[model samples]
Each structure stands twice: as structure tokens, then as C-alpha cells.
Target: MLDYLFAALLGVIEGITEWLPISSTGHLILADEFIHMSTSDAFKEMFDVVIQFGAILAVVVIFWSKLWPFRINRDACGSGVSGLVDRYCRKDVWDMWFHVLVAIVPSAVIGLPLDDWMTEHLHNPPVVSAMLILYGVFFLLMESTVGKRRPQVRRIGQINYRMALFIGLFQFLALVPGTSRSGATILGAMLIGCSRTVAAEFTFFLAVPTMAGASLVKVVKFLADGGGFSGSEVGILLTGCAVAFAVSMLCIRFLMNYVKKHNFKVFGWYRIGLGALVLAYFYLLKPAL
Candidate 1:
């Protein structure tokens, strides 16, 4: 019962933080310091990544029309497979997906090789705190300078292959704990002349594949290591995912609306404050205790 309750709480955290410029993984890591579950370390590690599957599903649901690259057509071009293909193929959507694929390459190439090393070494309070503060400053600086200019890329459709690849390269920075993948890509996009709305939308779209692939990898690695879920673990995982899905729906909607008129300055300040608190707790307060 207690485990389920904790899972729900973590789910709430994930749903809220995942969409925001705030780091969901960083928040989860910090939350774990206090909300220790009955699960093993391996299960907990896997749970953090897998729980994001729910959040990904939320994006898919909200952007179904935009993400789905197909359409129904009553008029036929041919009799069989060719007709079906002609009816369903959406060239624009397919092109957007190709851009997304190109953007993910830099991260996949770099992240895959360093996943284990980063998990073992960088997944800790000190590293998370440092990144939280560092990126918070980056956000502030970008907004003060670049935020003042008229953006060159104001629509999602305007984002071309070169821009997507540039954003993806920045995403590689997010491999470090607390860097926040969305934050990095959105910031990078903004720096490269994308409007706030366009940057946020593309970031949300980019997350679908990136996070789904990550969750799959985590699950595979867990099973490969002989980590099987007991009944309770399964229940806990589902509970967390369901809650995350529900909360993510609300959060994503809120973010899309919020970015239209506002900048990310508030989130930057919040990150800096949270990073300070984490550092003080782990290095100063906790050690004294």
C-alpha cells in the first residue's frame, strides 16, 4: 500500500516536471532521496526511465492529428496496395518525422556509448545540482539577449533540416543528469531563431521517439539482467504510469498555452533555487546531520 502511494507521488512529479523546462529525471532522483520504495535498486533505476512511457503516450494522444502521417481517401488511385498507399500517405508529416530522425542522430550516437558510464558516475546529487544551476543560467542569458530579438523561425513548418540537426546537437548536451532534454533542445532552437511556440512544439514532438527508445532500452536492460517484476512491482509500475499519463495531459496543455505569451524566466529562477537547495541538503545539511 505504501509503495503504491509513493509511486503515485512520483508519478505526479514526473508528469509535472517532464513537460516543463524543469528536469523530470533530476526531480525523480531527488525525490528518491526521501521517498524510498521497497523495490530493489535495479528496479528503481529502470522504473525512472520506464515511467516516462506514460508521459510519452500523453504527447501522442494530444498530438495525434499532427503526428499521424496518414489520411483516409475514398477515391482510389489503383485497385490494391498502391491505392492504399496513395490514400494514406501524408508527405508533410513524413518529412517532419525525417527531420526528427536526423535530430536524434547526434544524441543516439553519443548517448548510447556513454549511457552506462553516465548512469554510474554522473547520476548523483552533485552532478545534478551543478547541471541544474548551469542550465538555469543558460536559460536566463538566452532570454535576456536572444529573447529580445524577433525570431526567424516562427512556425513548426519553417524548421528545416539544418535547424533540426542544430537542435539535435544541443540535445546531446542533455545526456548529463539534470540537463533536461526538452530544455536543451528548446533553448538551442530559440538560440537559432525559433520562436518560443515553435521551439516548444518541436521539443514536444522530438520527445516522442527519444523517450520511447530510452524506455525500451531501459526495460530491455533490466530484463537482460534477470530483473523480473513481482506482482506488487507490476502494480506499482502501472499505478505510476497511469497517474503520469493523466497528469501529463494537463501539464502539456498548460505548457502549450503558457508559452504563447510568456518566456521561461520563471522556470530558470526555479531551477537555480532548487539546485541550491539540493546542494545545501546533500553537502552541508545532510553531512552535519
Candidate 2:
């Protein structure tokens, strides 16, 4: 009962924090530490990967129209038409699709090999603290230097393959525990001249493929390793997924509107403060471990 309850709590946290520039993995690690939710290695690993699916589904549900526009099949036109019937084909949407592919390739290539080793051995509280602080500093600097938001690249459609590739390279940094995938990717886009709103939205879209693929890969590996989930365990899993999806829907709606009027400096400050607090709690407040 306790484990199930904790899993639900963690899932809600993941959904709410995952899309934000804040580091969801970092928060998860911290929550586990504070709550003492210990588990077998296989189950622990599986929980981390599976919970992410909830967040990924939220993006798919929210952006279905943009991702898969209603395009009528021209070949279905049989009324003696010389050419294919007109459909909702936008050259820009196709181009954006191509760019998203370009952006996903780099992280997929680099992250697959390192994921197990990092999650198994390198997931530590001190590392999370350092990452939170370091990325917090980067966010602060990025917001100050790139204060002049550009208007040319307003939407994902405007992003070129080269920019996508650049963002992919930056995303590899997020393989570190504390550096957030969204945070790293957004900074990459902003550095390459994408506006804040564009960078944030692209991060949300890129996550659909990137996170889904990663989660699926992990689940496959866990099952291949002969790990079994009980009936009650499956119930807990579903509960977490549903909670995460519900929270993420609300978060996406608010963040899209919020960034239009403000910058990420507020998040940066929050990260710094949270990081420092984590350090103090573990090092000064608590007794030696």
C-alpha cells in the first residue's frame, strides 16, 4: 500500500516537472531519497522508465492536430481526376517533421549505451545537487545574454535541420542526472536564435519521440531481463500513469502562455534555491550517513 501510494506521488511529480525547464529526474532522485522508497534493482529501474510514458502521452494528446494534421488521401479520389485531390498538406508541417527527426537522432545514438550505467551506479544525491546548481547557473547566464528574443523563428516549422541537429547535440548534456532534457534543449535552441516560445514548444514536441523511444527501450530491456510485475504492481503503474497524464495536461496549457509574457529567469532562481536547499539538507541538517 505504501509503495503504491508513493508511486502515485512520484508519477504526479514527474508529469508536472517533466515538461518544465526544471529537472524531473533530479526531483525524482530527491524524492526517493527523502521518502526511502527502496526497491529491487529491476523494479526501481522499471519504475523510472515506465513513469515517463505518462508524461509522453500528455504531449501526444495535447498536440495531436499539429503533429498529425488531417490530410486527405489524394489517391482515394476516383472521379476521373487527372491529379491527386487537394488535401490539408502544408509544406511547412512536413519540414518540421523532418527537423524533429534530425533533432532526435543524436541523443538516441549517444544516450542508449550510457543510460544503464548511469542509472545503476551514478544516480547519487550529490551528483543531482551539483547538476541542479550548474544548470541553474547556465540558465541564469542564458537568460541574461539572450535577452533579445528573435521573431524570425517563431514556430517549429521555421526550424531548419541544422538547428535541430544543434539542439540534439545539446540534449546529450541532459544525460547527466540533474541537467534537464527540456532545459538543455531550450538553451540550445535559444543559442541558435530561436525565440523563447519557439524553444519551449519545440522542447515539448521533441519530447514525444525522444522520451517515448527511451521509455519503450527500457521496458523491453527490463522484460528481457526476466523481471516480473505482479497484478497489484500493475495497478500501481496504471495509477501513476493516469495521474501524470492529468497533471501534465494542466502544466502544458499554463507554460505555453506563461513563457510568452515572461522569461525563464524565474525558473533559474528556483533551481538555484532548490539546489542549495538540497545541499544543506543532506550535508548540514541531517546527521552523517
Candidate 3:
């Protein structure tokens, strides 16, 4: 019914913003206001975590072909584990996976505790709005101050483990509700000398693991709580997941090409505008919730 419809709408929002440097979590918080769902605090928490699974699924489905690389060429050979891996796998995919793993560790270590705290007390429009505006300002300053630019790194393979770890460390900041993991990582890559397009693409690739792990953790927590998940609920989740997956594929394709020719300044303006609106709604417009 209407719940299913709302689920789909949220899925679309999650998919598109999840991978973008824009804050998907921030959008989800704001979008929930439009769904007419109960505002009970527990329900709101469940809704936020559950819908993210949809976006996480999008990453898995859209990037499945590249996540695990296989070489059908048969003749490619080496020696030990690396040799056997080389014999059966394309070097490019293997290299990309390594960098992703490297980039994942920092956030994983720092986020485990921080995420719990944020979920407990920080899931509100005011926080999201402030983060969106503050990060937007950072984005604007980054582009203007860092004038040296270079050709895009051709593929994820071009990134080194050192850079990957640095990106992962930068990702820790995203544990704060307002600073985006993608935004922080992208900015870190650029600061370390990656072209904007290269940084964006690498951020997209890394999201598959980072977001998936976070989503799975949430799912496990929900299940462990012993709450019943009805057939209708499952259906709603699947619909959301499907919609997010499909839309995200398109978004990634479009963003990949878009960043090659443009800068992220436009998104900065967008974040600022959205942040201002949230602030207005919470402060100047709406009565206390």
C-alpha cells in the first residue's frame, strides 16, 4: 500500500545519494519527514537502518562483475597463491580489491563504536543540516584552495596501498553524522594528488565493501533483537533494494562521466541549500516535533 510506495521512494533517494559525495544519511533523515510514518523514536531508528540495506544491495549488484575478477584466458600463470590467483584472475580486479580492503580498515576500526553512539543520540534533522552546511563549506574551500590538478588516474589499480590507507583514515571522520564518508575520502584522494574524477571513481568502488559491511551489521543487530519480520515487511525491503540497485547503476554511470568534465562545486551549493532548508524547518518554521 502506501507504505510500500514510500519504501520505494526512500530507496531511490538512498541509492542515488549513497554513492555520491552528498550525504545519503542526511537525505534519508529529511525524506522520512515526508512519508507520514510514525515518529516514534524506535520506529524511526529501525526505518533509518533498514532502508540503508537497500542502498547497500545496490552496490553489491551494480559492481558484482568487477568485485571478483576472473580471467577466462586460461594460459595466464604464475607460481604460488599470487601465481594461482594471477592464473585465474584479472590483475586489475585483484589490485582494486586490495586497495579497497586497505581503505576499509581505518573506518572499520573507528566506526564500530562511533556508529553506535551516533545511532543512539544523533539521528536528527538539526545535526544533518549542520553537517551538510559545514561539509559544503569544506568542499568549496577544497576546490578553490587546491588549484593544482592532474589527469585522472586510469583505473583503481593506479592507486597505491599507502593512498588507500590514507583514504581509509580520512573515512574515519565520516563516523560523525555530518561529514560524509564518500566526501571525506574523495577530498583525501584529491589532497593526496588524485584528479577529481579519479578520486570520485575510487570512492565509488570502495563503497561496495564499506557500506555493505555497515548494512549487514545493522541487519544482524535487528535480527538479534528478536523482532518479527513479516512477509509484507520483507516485500517492502526487497522492493526498496531493487529500486535502489537499479537507480544507483544509472547514477554511477552518469556520475563517472560527469566528474570527468566538471567539478564538485555544484554539489557544494546543493548541500548548502538543503542544509539551510532543514535549519529553517527545524528552527524558523516547524513547531517542536
Q: Every model's Cα RMSD, please?
A: 3.0, 3.8, 4.5
lDDT of 1 by residue, 69-112 (tens): 98755356545553443455887888889999999999899888
Give the worst 10-residue stretch by lDDT in candidate 1.
77-86
Model 2 alpha-carbon drift over 4 Å, by segment:
37-39, 69-90, 149-151
lDDT of each: 0.92, 0.83, 0.76
Error of 1 at 273 (Å): 0.6
- Stretches of candidate 1 above 4 Å error? 74-86
Q: Model 2, range 126-242, lDDT digits (tens) per residue? A: 888888888888889988887565556777777888999999998888888878999999999999888888898889888988888888887898889988788877877787888
Residue pairs in candidate 1 whose N, alpha carbon or C atoms collide under 3 angstroms? none
List, residue by residue over 1-289, the lDDT tens digit for candidate 3: 8778877888788778877788887787788677764333444456565666666655566667767687554234533344333445677888888998999998888778677788767778888888899889888888887634554555667799999999888887777666677888888888887887778877877877787788767777766876556777777777777788778878877887888888888888888998998899989888866
Identify the leading candidate in terms of TM-score: 1
Question: What is the lDDT, from 0 to 100, of the residue 264 in candidate 1?
Answer: 94
- When summed lDDT is taken over every stretch of 10 residues in candidate 3, the lowest stretch is 78-87
